[model samples]
Target: MAEYMRLRQICLVAPQLAPVIADISAIMGLDVCYRDGNVAKYGLENALLPVDTILLEVVAPFQPGPGTAAGRFIEKTGGRGGYMAIFACEDPDARGAKANAMGVRTANVITHAPYHGVQLHPRDCRAAFIEFNHTDGSDDILGPYPPAGPDWQKSIRKDTTLSLTEVEMQSPEPEGLAAHWGRIIGIPADGPVVKLPNNTFRFVKGDSEIMSGLTFKVVDKAKVLEAAKARGCAVKGDEFLLSGVTFKLTA
Candidate 1:
């Protein structure tokens, strides 16, 4: 089995992409890295933001077609909150095979083309697009998954203060979801909090069986909430307003 790196990114979808991107930037203090042109096939556009090298991507559908599955994902999840959680892997193929061994099928495999990526079904992950990917020959993880084009580093801008940091997950069956993800990623699923070298995955159960709402680690969780509140975003405990997406703050 191949060892993996820290958590890489989390993807969010919006009915429209630009506003959400703006919202995340204004609210979270993150810088937009670039938008990937390849997403045009799925009738979608995307922007990548760096939170300590953990990519935060916001995507919106521009048109529905063969390549973009954003439409189907939106329809299935009734819009948005947290769409996908992507992680770094030393060997995507090896990890992909591990997932397959556990009865989880790969949804797609993106290779050499730039980055090597493999996605597992959400059902297997309990409602999330779990991707394990690595860029060939370089530990410069962010550069491989180009936000705009295949020029490699053109899309990645490192933020020394920003760390991929932490991820919070809300699921109806927290333990079950964690365990399921553990099998998929070869990580232990024993607690509410699963910590990695550069990040953490925290799980909490809610009323519905579906997973929802996520919190990303920021420099100041309180400041993020205050900023959002001032901008007319509703704040309830750790989460803020819903505009097809829910942003939460957790330490």
Candidate 2:
């Protein structure tokens, strides 16, 4: 079985970039590393931020045409959920082949010298788009993540958000959803949780299949909430709904 090294990043899609990108940067105290021009092929614009070694990305469609997958996601969830859960692996092709053999749809394969990736179809995975990638000679978690653009690691700011600990996937049937994802990702479901090496995928009961929320290990939860509340996000307890997804801060 192929093993995922770590939870590489969480990708979120928003209807618009402005307030969504602004709120995430201000509230979470994360630095915007790069505005990737690479996604132009998909008719989308994106911003990448380093949340420690793990990344937080938000993509919005520049063109609302057939090429915009992010636009499709926003329309599907009514702009109310997470989009993709990406993982870093030693060899993504092995995992991609495994998923392929299981009848899962392999969506895309991107390679640029040292970096290579395979994206799995969301319809087959059932909850979120699953992507796996590897940097040719680098196994370090803090090494180059080519998808985030160069100079991405230089943007790491740990004074506020420390780590992305959990990614929440929601569905009407949590157990079954987790099981389906488990078969695809090669991770066993712990009841409703898909336990990974560094973090966990939490399958929660909800109306539809979507990546719903993220749990962040933070330095100041109060400060984050205050910033989020000021930005007009729907705050409930320590969590807030922003960019069509939930942000849960924990110390």
Candidate 3:
């Protein structure tokens, strides 16, 4: 099995980027790290924010048109939710081969100089899309993650939000879905959680298979929740629903 070095990034989608981006910036007290120019080629727009070493991204379609994957994703998942989970690994080719052998569809391959990324089709895994990337010869966990754009780490701001502590994947059959994802990612599904070096991928019960929520280690959970409420998000217990996903804060 190819070793996954760390949790590099999490991609979420919104119906529209404006409101969601504003809400995330205000509630999390984080700024946009980079608006990747490459996304426009995919008929989408994106904004990434670095919280500690992890990249939190929100993607939206550039225009409402048929056949665009982002548009279809919104309709499939019923508008705005977690879309993709990316990890940095020591060897992407070996890991990708493992998934390919397991009957996972290879969606796309991206390469730019020293960085190489492989994207797997979401349907094959029965959850969200999974991506494995590697920067040639880079071993430092805190080092460059190319998908978030160069200099993403330089944009790290830690006032309210810190690290992405957990990713919550919801499905009616969580155990089965977890096993599928575990096999695809080369991580063992131990109960409902797949443990990574920097974060945990948690599978929980829901109506369907989707990435439903994210848990962040925050500097001030109450204050963050309060900010979320002030920004017109409906507060529920320790979480606030935004962009069709629940953002849970923990101190």
- Using lDDT as the measure, the top candidate is 2
Return the TM-score for candidate 3, rounded to 2 decimals: 0.95
Per-residue C-alpha lDDT of model 2 across residues 1-251, encoded as one tens digit per residue: 33556788888888778778899898998889888787888888889889988889999998664458888887777887878888888789898899999889899998887888899998888877899888865587777777777788899999999989998889999999998888777887878988988888899999888888899999999988999989998889999998878899899
Candidate 1 wrongly placed segments (more than 4 Å): 64-68, 140-164, 209-211, 217-223, 242-246
Instruction: Arrange candidates by TM-score, descending.
Output: 3, 2, 1
Task: Name the 10 consecutive residues with the lowest summed lDDT in model 1.
Answer: 152-161
The lDDT for every candidate, in the order shown, is: 0.69, 0.85, 0.85
Off by over 4 Å in 2: 1-3, 65-67
When 1 and 3 are scored with lDDT, the better candidate is 3
Q: How does model 1 score by TM-score?
A: 0.83
Mind sharing the TM-score for model 2?
0.95
Error of 1 at 110 (Å): 1.2
Is 1 or 2 the stronger prediction by TM-score?
A: 2
List the candidates ranked by lDDT, beginning with the highest.
2, 3, 1
Per-prediction backbone clash count: 7, 0, 0
TM-score of each: 0.83, 0.95, 0.95
